[model samples]
Target: MAAETKQSCYEGSSVSSFQFYLERSGEHEAILRCVRDVLPREFKRTGADKSSLDVLGVGSGGGQVDVQMLTMLQSTNPGVPITADIVEGSSELSDNFRALVEKTPNLEKIPFAWNIMHSGDYEKAVQAKGNMKKFDFIHMIQMIYYVDDLADTIKFYHSLLKSNGRLMIIVEGEKGGWDTLWKTYQKELCVDAITQYRSSGEVIACAKSLGLKYEELPVPNQFDITDCFDPSSQTGERLLNFMTAKDNFYESLTPEIRSGILDLLRHKCSTEKDGRVMFDSKLSCILIHA
Candidate 1:
């Protein structure tokens, strides 16, 4: 028998480390706030009294945001049942999500079907089911970066919606500091065909080209990346790996290239405030209506 390789790089310590970074940087909080603010206004209630709302979550990580969205949905449509289809590629994340569900109060009100598979796999499964079901709400949060064809994926998700269904997508903005870093090093780091650094600007263009009806909002965010300047800092190295999705990313580069990148990050990508290096980490919230 052959060895079974891991499908996702988000394993064990890396997951927790990335979560720590997200927490410390307040990225998760900002995104949550943005979602809470927009979801109520953007989510369209179709057949509210006829049937339960079916939701599809692509690459839903760890169920934290999933629970939040579900709570909002339940609040919006009181006494309505919800069926959630959670598609996540990481086993660790899925397990954590299950645990979270167990601990979350009133989560039993919403039934969940967890699919430990990638988005492509979920697509195949849906196709194999002969399109028997359609979703009322669908969300893809910061997960399109791993897809091979972004536009096709978005279109496919849109196709799987019931009337008045809404698809929400979150991604980095073009003018954000992370976007500058990604554009500079994407060619070098993104060797995998499925992996690419994309911004909401590109997504908006794609949606417009497809003639899709959409609304977009900006989620202003920031992160302290000062640790990334210290070459000897383990947290710095881990943060770089998290950002670039490459192992030993900072160490692999030539000293000159590394120095140049560091200088760019310090001067162009980040601003020093109260002795902390704060990066301009803005996110985009895009809602596509079906």
Candidate 2:
């Protein structure tokens, strides 16, 4: 078992790597499509008796996507007061989110409470238990894998939802490079205690165990990983580093381990297309009804 503690991109100056990962993986198109496909219906479900709506965004990195979702919510429920609570652990990302909110039209009108803390810490401080009905909409996108207890986190978030509330969680599906990568080398790749390999399949199982009512939507996505094999390519290096959750992955690992990982990533996690290696970046979106 590899035990050397390493810095995650969340705490390091590797936001660029993360950004590269998103770009290569074609995440925005699918995620933005999800926001458009789901949020309007969720907004329509808002209880007529409620004077205002509350939104909780967990692991809201950079806030671009969150802003898009919130904008949709505002458009759907115009004239109604909407409060958005952003929970992000990275100070840099939270700052980015803050700066983004400033420039986004119609967002400044809504009150935003920025809690720059890990979801685990946020959960610890949460005193409210089941049936709180405190939130109308709650979303944890691309961040559930970092939580200590996914089951408990789901339950807690579900409890915070109102009768008509919805909890939307988006994560890597079992059919993605992330799942394949982690299953093959999780112990070696995971540097922090927060790192986990749980996919949407596990999320479904957890929700089932909790007997929570939910719907699953699979978003087909892929990544152009043709550059990952080129050692001299900076973009490829960034994607590889992001994939391994390590900084300077090539220089840091032993040759045998490095070669083995590359082999696994190239063969098992991706497929050769028309002169390009396309990675399966499929994501699963689970909407839990409260």
Candidate 3:
């Protein structure tokens, strides 16, 4: 992943990482294929009498991916109407997403509403209102790790879903990469206040503990990390910081720790070919019916 300066990668720092991952890994296509393949059944399960579909997007950054998913839903359902409600904490990101929506050709046709608040805040406000709106579909991608209680959050969202509604969760895969790196050095590297290393495996385990059944698909991913090898590159260091979920990781690193991390990244996690190192950041997506 490429990076701009930020305390943590997940804190709305660089869209470059997302764009790069989508470009190289084709995760967007994989996700879209899953959506296309499953939505037909979900829509049918939702019943033919519904006049419109209520879709909730949690932590939908910049709206690029959410818009595409909405488009897919609209295309799949054809005549069925869609109402999109998005929750995002960053006002700037929400504004940018709104601007994107304004320029999008047919997306203007969908009814869109943005709630500029953190997911927890949104949940609190809605619960305070005492009239929870049930949704036909809800998607929380790459943001589950931010919550305090994973199982509780999952259960809360499940409660808000209609009988046949579907909830989609996308998270880091537990196959390799940081999953391996963190095993040895998480306490040193993951120094953030919220340093939960919850991955798809944890999510699946939590789901089972809650007695919720789900189906999932793996989304294999890779990132060009050749720049990370260049100590003189500012982007390289920033990307390292993001990778570690720590601020100033370069300056804070002792020579021994730095060498250890780099060695692990190169040999234990990443692959080298044609003078470029590719970091495999595999992800997984799961679908559950309420």
1 or 2, greater by lDDT: 2
TM-score of 1: 0.92
Q: lDDT by residue for model 2 over 84-140, one digit each (tens)?
A: 998887777778889999999988899998877788777776754432338999998
Scored by Cα lDDT, where does model 3 land?
0.74
| 1 or 3, greater by TM-score | 1
Q: Mind giving the per-residue lDDT tens digits that candidate 3 earns over 1-290?
A: 21111223334444554554456555566566666776666666674678888999987777777877777777768788788999887665677789988887678878888887777777889889999998999998777766768888898888889877889998778866757776668778655534566778889998899999798888777777677778998777766776775557677888788889988888878898888888877778888779
What's the best-to-worst order under TM-score?
Answer: 1, 2, 3
lDDT of 1 by residue, 1-290 (tens): 00001256366776876686676678778889998888886553553554578999888877788888888887788777789989888788888889998888787877888888778777888889885568998988878777768888898999988888888988887778878887887766566533467889889998998999999999999888899988788888877766655567666777776787788788888899999898888889899989
Rank ordering of all candidates by lDDT, starting from the highest: 2, 1, 3
RMSD of each: 3.7, 3.5, 3.4
When summed lDDT is taken over every stretch of 10 residues in candidate 1, the lowest stretch is 1-10
